[model samples]
Target: MNTHNLIVGISGASGALYGIRLLEACRDLGVQTHLVISKAGEMTLHHETGLAVSDVRALATKSYKIADIGAAIASGSFRNAGMVIAPCSIRSMSEIATGVTSNLMTRAADVALKERRRLVLMVRESPLHSGHLATMKTLSDLGAIIAPPVPAFYTHPTSLDDMVNHTVGRTLDLLAIENNLAERWDGLKNARTRSQENDGGRD
Candidate 1:
């Protein structure tokens, strides 16, 4: 498979591990990643993951400061496959939706949409107000995929890591990247196997 370059932004939202694991999955798939972390992201990184900014930057192929709008990633000509904002805050999402990027993180996302490239927002808010939902609709209309980091219980995830990996894997699928980070849904694979075995008994 051809190598894909993806831009990842970690906003100030909780569930910062989702962002960290995304970088790790990109490493496993050999997907070159350009990562940007906001000021709130930096704080949440320490608050939630207990990891320093340097440690998180170590996971990406390239890292950009939230203030650096002049970075290559802030332009459409950079030609990345897509951009994902893991645990995207409502403020960042609103910024992207409104085309008013006050920082490099949302600027990159705006570039992706303007370039007709994939832009996935892992919006990490709940009990969203009408304003939030409207912004999401505006983004969706603009071809940005709004994804929340909700776990899939049907996969029978045995641990938090399992849930995280599976959710991230599924999210990356939107970018058309190959990943075996979690078990895929095969329309009840085990149940189908059991049914076939039971039928074979009649033979």
Candidate 2:
């Protein structure tokens, strides 16, 4: 497997920053990223980040059109580390779960599953219904990871960037890509010790 190559898919989900930051992180880590963004994802990117689709595409090592089902990344033999659907929309999640891919983004994801490669779906939905939960379970049973982009408060994130970085860092960890984007958790004792040390001079 080509561990340096990763497939990044952006669906029509609200947290476009996750996908963008993932791309940037991969770039910094020297990982070659093959990116595909859905039409709806493009709109969400502009609406949420004011970044044109082209700007986001520039961050990736390579970019593909959502309709290009014949793209290299869509093939099982593409030999990438795996695929990640950042901010995966419920629609795309359901499509992949059903094995009825309608576009290159979903198609590449299906390829990853069939190839028995790591497939991470950052499903971004609120108040998921039973049907959605069942769909996620189905994907999990098939060896696909349903990693929603939930933030970790243990990192004491002070900004949106910190939260996003933490999520992206964990996602990268799933692919065995080592990175310092996430703040490692120390033991409770260490945490308390730090707190006490800081309090010694305060009061």
Candidate 3:
């Protein structure tokens, strides 16, 4: 496989763990990640996830200042396979929707959209207002995938890590990276077969 490149951005949202999990998954897959974190993201990471900025930085292959608009990833010709904005905040969503490339995160997203590469925004807010919905629509119309990080209970997640892995795994799927972070429905076939055999014997 060619070296799949991903641009990951973390914004001020409640779920910093999602981003961290995503980074870990990408690293394990040997995908080169260009990471950017907003100022509020740093604050949220500390307050909610109990992760220091240094620790978060350690997860990524490379880290860029959000204000570093001149970064290679900020350009359309950067040749990245895709971009993902994990735990995307409403503010960041609106900026990308309106084509405001103020920072490296938004700029890289804009580049992804323009380049027609996969751009998955894991919007984390809930109880959306008209403005937020409208922004999502706008980005969607521009070929961006607005993936809200809604939990999947059907997976029978046992802990917080399971939930985080499921969402991050789906995000990786969107980026076309193969990962086994979450259990797939097809894997249950063997269990179903065993259950049927036991029921037959009992009958």
What is the lDDT for 127 in model 2? 93
Kindly report which residue stretches of model 1 are placed more than 4 angstroms away from their true locations once superposed: 189-203
Q: Write the per-residue lDDT of candidate 1 for residues 1-203, one digit (tens) a residue.
A: 32978999999999899999999999888999999999999999999988988999999999999899999998888978899999899999999999999999999999999999999999999889999999999999999999899998876677999999998998888999988876766788685665568679443
lDDT tens per residue, model 2, 1-203: 22479999998899999999999999988899999999999999999999989999999999999999988998887988999999899999999999999999999999999999999999999999999999999999999999999999875678998999999999998999999998787898787676677679353
Which pairs of residues collide in model 1?
A: none
Instruction: Please identify which of the two predictions, 1 or 2, would achieve the higher TM-score against the true structure.
Output: 2
Output the better candidate (2/3) by lDDT.
2
Pairs that collide in candidate 3 are none
User: Which scores higher on TM-score, 1 or 3?
Assistant: 1
Q: Where does candidate 1 have its weakest 10-residue lDDT segment? A: 194-203
Worst 10 residues of 2 by lDDT: 194-203
What TM-score, over all chains together, does every model reach? 0.92, 0.95, 0.91
Q: Kindly give the number of clashing pairs for every candidate.
A: 0, 0, 0
Model 3 residue runs over 4 Å out of place are: 187-203
Q: What is the C-alpha RMSD of each candidate to the true structure, in Å?
A: 3.6, 1.6, 3.0
Instruction: List, residue by residue over 68-101, the lDDT tens digit for candidate 3.
Output: 9898898887888899998899988888888866
Candidate order, TM-score descending: 2, 1, 3
